[model samples]
Target chain A: MAKYLSKLSKSTRSNLYTVTAILAAYIIFTVLIATGNMSNLLQGLLIQIFYYAILAISLNLTVGILGELSLGHAGFMCIGAFTSAFFSKCTVDIITITWIRFTIALIIGAISAAIFGAFIGFVVLRLRGDYLAIVTLAFGEIIKNVINVLYIGIDQSGFKFSVKDSVSLNLGEGGQAIMNGPQGIFGTPNDTNLTICVFLLILFYIIISNLVNSRSGRAIMAIRDNRIAAESIGINITKFKLLAFTISAAMAGVAGTLFSHNITILDSKKFGYNQSIMILVFVVLGGIGNIRGSIIAAAILTLLPEYLRFLENYRMLIYAVVLIIIMIINWNPTCIAWRKKYSIRNLLSAINKKKEA
Target chain B: MSFISYLIKGISLGSVYAIIALGYTMVYGIAKMLNFAHGDVIMVGGYILFTVMTSLGQSPILAVLASIVFCTLLGITIERIAYKPLRKASSLAVLITAIGVSYLLQNLALIIYGTETKFVTSVIPIPTIKLAGGNLAIPGQTLVTIPVCIVIMVSLTVFIRKSKTGRGMIAVSEDKGAAVLMGVNINKTIAITFAIGSALAAVASVLMFSSYPSLTPTSGAMPGIKAFVAAVFGGIGSIPGAMIGGILLGIIEILGRAYISSQLADAIVFLILILVLLIKPAGILGRKMNEKV
Candidate 1:
């Protein structure tokens, strides 16, 4: 373990900086929680922030690394949320044995979501750009509608077997329900302990960071940059894209499982296209393909609405204005020109190629 | 006999979708970007018509004209604000901005109009005419909608084929750099395209509201998506192709719902899209342009 750690440290070289930053963040989180001045509402709000952050990071895996735009990611989250909720409500023991149930739920949810993701990836991953985006969007809508219909079960033998009446699952009246149709499933057991959730989130961050730096990650990046070129060089674009998508979907499922278990509620509306877009916003606003940037952007955007509560009726307007400003700044010609002129890495790479030749 | 009536009804419904699909196709043809907010602009047009009809208590004809003007202005505004800045950016950036604009418009409508569905009275009279063994009844709105759509489509075809600005728009869509070199004002042409497309959306909205008198803030989302599918089905950047695609999609959706399970409506449409994409990625009416890789 020590040797591995040393090797990791040597490879990263900037490990100390990251470690210190993480430690500082942990300290700050603890301090904020310990302070009595922070209301329970604020704490709950922070938990929600962390939940979305996990989702955003997971989605970034596909959107950033694979360079594929999936508008239907929320569908996978819905699958995860529903599957976990169904299992957790299967027996009282599962609910009571919180920690074990949580772990089991995450695993099951992730696997199921990954399977679904792989299935979709096999079919739609062949398409690129706008075609992929539209198909994914359609897939998401289909899932939502199907879930909506299936949630209300058929009448059986005079005894209506609704999601609510399913035996072994007793999450109060609302909790046991699979998905309460339009009203959404309620009584979800809030088993996501804050510390564990944060820890899992950090773990995911590490995994993604590692994946982005690995050989497989480089191959995925190459595919994104030039698919035809990558394929010509013996890189299997289809295989790598599917792998990335599956991993990303699994991460999203994990996030959804945590969310469902934590919030104790599951709504199809919560997993709609809007939520998918919201996650995409976090990825984009944070500077796509940048892990640190994605995390920070997710946290800030998640928390921004809460801080802007005072805006009241004008909150949406203010939000729109802010978005417009960000877009304008990001699109400024001067900024583009500067980036193009001073792209040192590209220049250095050019020089290196010349030297090698 | 009723089958014939259903077919007519399907055609009328398809016509509305075709009108909306034109906007999507034209903008995509010139811009190569899916204006996700285009449907919301239709919603905006509906709301404007609603406001005009209610406040002024004017005739439906006048209200529709007003709505068209409002939609044209809104379209121009959207181009100026949301799309103009990202004209040179990557397609992804423009697509995201389009989504942002869509959300912004939907939420704005929600705030302004409230979440509750608003009722709009039918502007066109419902009339019945006997044809075969059964009576063939066509909504007066269909008569108006069909003729108006036909007129607009024909005029647009003529404009695109003959007029200098229309030719300029086509030229830009074909080759932006060459068109610019030939003294076509790209910005002005783009703005004009948006205006024309949005105005068409407004007309469809008015007709749609007449057919179904309830309006909600998010009503544009599904219609917008369907129109997009129509555009894709015909060919993304083809004008007449959009019309054909829209009508066909409408017929398929309505007939599918009537004949097949209503639950399968959305699935069938998406299935068609996927199948089309797999078979002919350039779309049925769309010509394939070879890319220099």
Candidate 2:
């Protein structure tokens, strides 16, 4: 451990510290679950933490890295959840293997979300700041409302989609309904588990981290820092913005698939603007532009409600207070310089000096 | 409902939206920040009126006056507490703080009023007006709403155009530093803008919940968003544009609800916003300005 720590750059070493701490915690929790020591409620929280982490990381790309604010992250997640859940429901009898079915579902989810991301991002990304924020928010609300009235079913003939009512999906005796228009697509098979969730999180972390560290990532950040400067240097503004938004959407879609498989039933109401706001809060609290911060924020906030069960009704109120405090702490200039004084780097350097003495 | 009746309903709803959207546009025009908690002021207005009318047994006129005064104060307080510190902060930070204030208000209402819907009796006591040779009917509330909206919009425009205080607001919104150099009381102008905008919100909520009396903590949320959409649909910083946008949004929303899927009303509103923003990024009436390099 000492040898591994000795030769690395300070930033890399600190990042390693964050990664190791999260990993160690996860490992310990997994053991507790395996031994049946953890509560059922906490076990459920594990799946949520993974998916929320995926969402926060994806949002960080557009919000933190790309410097675009989106109030419609849940819109992409909705498309993902409904599409993948619907796909899984229809193919239940035909596809026996859960793993294979989930793989196909994830791919479909990613593609569909990317398609939507491209369509919306292409239009809205042309503008910047408040306009982009509002349009994305509108998109999210539109998707949620549309999903409320959407109906789909499957039968011997093939797949069918309807909007008016469920009865319109006339089918054979063995026909099955996936989404009954506002009733939501129910009867989804529970294929999500700790292993799959952890795998997805790890994959998301690596992809997002690598992207943030890449040349394109630098270009993206450059555009965010100064649009005209980035443009003067001949950076293709639209291309990179589109790339980041599409990738972010695709990742959210993957998270949505995992989310659907984890939950017993899927509903449009679950993916409202409020849900999007909550995810944004996670990104903000996690430390904008910090992937490790996103992971930790998602985990803690997702589990906060369950842990604060005794506080019950006051939990969200308290959560609001915490959110304000965190935002103030993060942005307040005096607090920032103060943070540097107590920051881990300072603490580490102090410890090293003591060791040398 | 006949096309005309639907149109009326749409107009009335549009009027409510216009009043609310005007508040949004004024604040945006002056402060250069989306006052997310602006909608909550409407909710606060409704509850205040509800308490006055129901609890204190005050007359409708008294209740409304009280509501306007209380909300105006509330708006000024909110700006001073939540937004003042965020003046030099990034727009995103201000935006987030605005949202946090929104959540704080909603949850506080949840705690105080509880989760159940609190019904408020209609403020407009007039009977329904029937047209189409006595075949079509309009709610009494609708009749009151349309005129009130028109009055508010015209007066607001005149206020912004003719009044020195209003001109100060425009100057501040244009460039705060320049306004300061020009001897504009930047803080006072911004505070007055908040006060006037919030006063309008109180008026809007009272009228909005008159017909739709199923009030809850979340009642302001949807209207708040739709009004924001209206503000954007017109032009973020333009008053007349907001009025036109609010009315058009009402018509579009009502028509969609009646002719298309009723459940897709919200979606239709948002879709229009997206389409408008894509085609005319500056909005229908918004002035286009070049971003500084």
lDDT tens digits, residues B1-293, model 1?
A: 66666777777888888999999999998988889899998788888888878866888788888989988999999999888988987666677788778878988888888889887777777665556544777767777878887898899999999999999999999999999999999999999999999999998898898887889988888888888888888888887888888888888887777886576677677777888877887678988766557
- Candidate 2 has a TM-score of 0.94
Off by over 4 Å in 2: A1-16, A334-357
Error of 1 at A8 (Å): 7.1
Best of the candidates, TM-score: 2
Q: Candidate 1, residues A211-326: lDDT per residue as tens digits?
A: 88899999999999888889889998888999999998898888888888876557676877777888888888777787767778877887777788898866766676677667
The fnat score for candidate 1 comes to 0.24
Error of 1 at B120 (Å): 1.9
Interface RMSD, prediction 1: 1.9
